[model samples]
Target: MKLGEPTLDQLHIFIAVAEHGSFGGAAKAMGRAVSAVSYGIAQLEAQLALSLFDREGSRRPVLTPEGEGLLAEARAVVDGVDALLAKARSLHAGQEPSLTLVIDVMVPGEVAARVLGNFRRMFPTCALTLRIEGLGAVAACLIEGGADLAIGGPVIGDHPALERQAVGELDLVPVAAPSHPLARPDVAPGESRRHLQLVLTDRSPLTEGREFSVLSPLTWRLGDLGAKHSLLKEGLGWGNMPLGMVAGDLASGALVELDLPEKPGAHYGLSALWRRDTRLGPAASWLVDAFRDGLGD
Candidate 1:
């Protein structure tokens, strides 16, 4: 059966009222005047040759069985309409690619800053915006076209069209201030076993199952390296450091490295992604490349 339909705004208003059980509730949700919302629903009913809301003999309107059926169809129609609108908005938001890049909080501290800094320097015309979110959220923003590009951890799942490239590896080293007793250049063998670790725990520290010092006088837990560093520099506790972030600090003696028995590093990679099916406009395409060139990705 060929079905003709009411417009999306009308359909949306219908669904809002259908779900909310009151025109006034729907109006509040839609942020539309009650009269406008009512008119939209009325138009939707007229276009469909169906009475969507039950008229209680000029009393408060209610849904009949037929109205119940219409509500089901209305929900599906509204959802599709919402998706179509979102796709259009994503294109508009991502088309030019002249917007901000949000970096995940877990991203390499140096890489995030460098990527944005170089992106702006290379394309001064394109405004560079920065934000912080979780790794999963960063990927979602890129896919949703809300964010142009992000430099963060490896995105799980298959994204054939999305460009996932590695920019650098993160060498996680136990680090501390020169004033700390653990600031040693060489561990003859098991010397590091006695060192106390200031750990970051969104979960147990990655070093938990490994052969290393556990701060048995267990103290000083931080969720962010920035916070840990602030405390570390204040002589609060010793913790692991991203080599990239502390390179300058280490060189200038602002921080010192504690020797590890072996290489303990997380292979941190930066990935650039976009929809395979969609063509980024000149501006967005250029921004993608600017990100690559920044990291030499």
Candidate 2:
């Protein structure tokens, strides 16, 4: 005799019976009659052409070897169907199924972590992807359709194709290793021009010919902020760094804040960026507000 496919109801009854160890227990758990639970299992076994339970002499039902082997597979099917239903429900509620975000490297890691943790709790069903980029690369990701939203610096703030909202600001302070001449308290402000300054270079062409807060003509351009931090600690060059990133260095005397005549240090503004033509989904909107609240201080 050819076997037939099991129905979802039959699968549920099989799982319930296996879990409860008795037809009466399964019935109570499912809010059904004991006879109905037993009949459903009987039909399932007949369709599968297998003896799923060994109820010969035991007072409670017990799964046979075949039933034990197929239990995990049944659970997987049920779990997949449940996940499908959840995604459908999220869609019905106007939530995005997935979101991609790019953030500027200048944002404090602690701030990002705190906001993202809350996001996960608030939008458990929304899938999230994250990227960390420097300067214009953050905005480039959003403008090129690689990200749903971006938290970037001032470089892309005025782009006509993108809309933005101010999120927060970071204080960029010029710093150098304690051993560097620029760190000397009596060093004249104009003397910094003679030394090499470490400056962050943009990865994308969005800011190709433009420079921000660059004070020295003699400079070493670096693509990564971390590299600049490490170089500053090594006395290789002096550069402006976010206060949040180098606060410990200044406190410990590993690095010292430089007082330049031009006052290159300034507040770096951060903003959330997205394409002007698109409206944000629920999860993305929540994220923008969360970032603003987390970093607003």
Candidate 3:
């Protein structure tokens, strides 16, 4: 006998029956008649040449081993189709299929979390990917189309292909463990230069040969801020960190604020940048607005 094609509607009915454990229950849940739900399942099993339900001895039909295996496959297929339809509908409404957001490590944690939470609720159908990078790497991602948005640093110098908007400034304070030599009250500029300064280095060549607020001759260049925080706490080196990130450390005496005579504390600007040519989708635009608004605080 020639096999028939199983329809999506049949699969939906099969899933409902498997989940509800009986045709009558599935019919009640789906607002269909019991006979219709049973017939759909029977047709599906016949098309696939499988005995899905065993009706020999049970009060309610129970799944055969074959039926148990097919149930999971049916649910996955149904869910895949649903997701495909959702993505299509989202595209039809001008939503992006996915967004790539690259953030500078300096961006305030609270602001990033609030904006991302809002983005998820506002654009449930769109996918989001996040990358955390420091300095020039943030701009490189935007320039190379590796990211849809960037929330970070001294944006790769005036590029015509990029657009930047001010977010807020992070207060970069030089700090060290209280036991570190530089934290002493009478530490001189020449004396401080001998101790290691943990400086965040950029891999992107955009800032090659450039250093920011580096006052020490002996230095350790790191790519991650978290690593710098850890090294500072270990009395390994002294470095600048965002005040928001180290406030607790400062207050708890785990780390002490350094008073470097050559370089005082500085405010580094956080900005939102994107490709000038590619217009942002509604979700991305909304996020940019949220970040700009948060800069007020």
Candidate 4:
């Protein structure tokens, strides 16, 4: 804001001149008069108290060591200004500055990948933050106002305040490493309870007393699906995993599916959740639609 400080327009011209290497060429490329381009650079140099170009006895202006350093800074300033303008335009068009999403591990990876890829293309200016949680933790994030949208299982407390729609369900299969005792086809229920079971524990208190699809009395609670998958692969324990997560393992014989009469194969449906009182902006709404469409596909 100082009297001699270089303006964004001047910086843009300076960058163009630096890139093109001559006043005449920069002017021609930018569709401006050479004199105007030259004057802008002169003013910028004077304001910054630095000689940006070596014009002595040369047809094309050459950048000095100092000029090279300042050129990078000038280009950065111009880009920042352009981005500021774009953000203002996005605000005027009702696009949110940022969107936060909390997704469950049970959500199909392919569905999430497809939706997120489309989202990036559709809303390049909108900042996105993604978090992966387990079961009730997904809805807890929405309830706590920590996320703008949630894609996961149902929550227990204060459900009325949450608006949600079913997107898709994941089929979970009981699996164990090939070396685990349960990997055998004829393993009995009594024998299964004696060994350890890997289970995904809820981080939120919403499902504190409730357990779903848990057959074994002895268990190890884990929050991350990847960790459970690793332990299962290492023959540490047996547990249910989404079919997609373990499909390759199942096929490769790294893991074997267990038939548990006590706990049949189960489905965990993903729900797109948001607060009922908050109105979604363009980016958030688009994400919801994208998730629904991806699930349908």
Per-residue lDDT for 270 in model 3? 80
RMSD of each: 13.0, 2.4, 3.0, 2.8
Pairs that collide, model 3: none
TM-score (all chains, Cα) for each model:
0.48, 0.88, 0.85, 0.88
Model 4 per-residue lDDT tens digits across residues 1-297: 444767888888889888998999899999999999999999988898888899999999999999999888887788888888988999999999999999888877888888899888878789999999988888889888899998877545349879887877778899998888777776666677888999989888767889877777899999888899999999999999999889999999999998765665787777789999999889988877888778667
Candidate 1, overall lDDT? Answer: 0.64
List residue ranges in candidate 1 displaced over 4 A: 1-100, 105-129, 134-137, 140-148, 155-163, 185-196, 199-221, 274-280
TM-score of model 1 (CA atoms): 0.48
Best by lDDT: 2
Better of 2 and 3 by TM-score: 2
What TM-score quantifies how close candidate 3 is to the native fold?
0.85
lDDT of 3 at 134: 92
For 31-62, candidate 3 gives per-residue lDDT tens digits of: 99999998998899989999998988886888
Candidate 2 minimal-lDDT segment of 10 residues: 181-190
lDDT of each: 0.64, 0.90, 0.87, 0.85
Q: Please write out the lDDT profile of model 2 over residues 1-297, one tens digit for every residue.
A: 888999888889899998988999999999999999999999989998999999999898889999999888888888788788888999999999999999899999999999999898888788899999999999899888999999999976699889999988999999999888888777776788889999999988888888877777998989889899999999998999999999999999999998777778999999999999999999999989998998886
Q: Write the per-residue lDDT of candidate 1 for residues 17-136, one digit (tens) a residue.
A: 877888889999989898999898788777777787886775566887777887777778877766567556646655443565666565565555675666556554455567675435
Clashes of each: 0, 0, 0, 0
Q: Candidate 3 at residue 275, lDDT?
A: 93
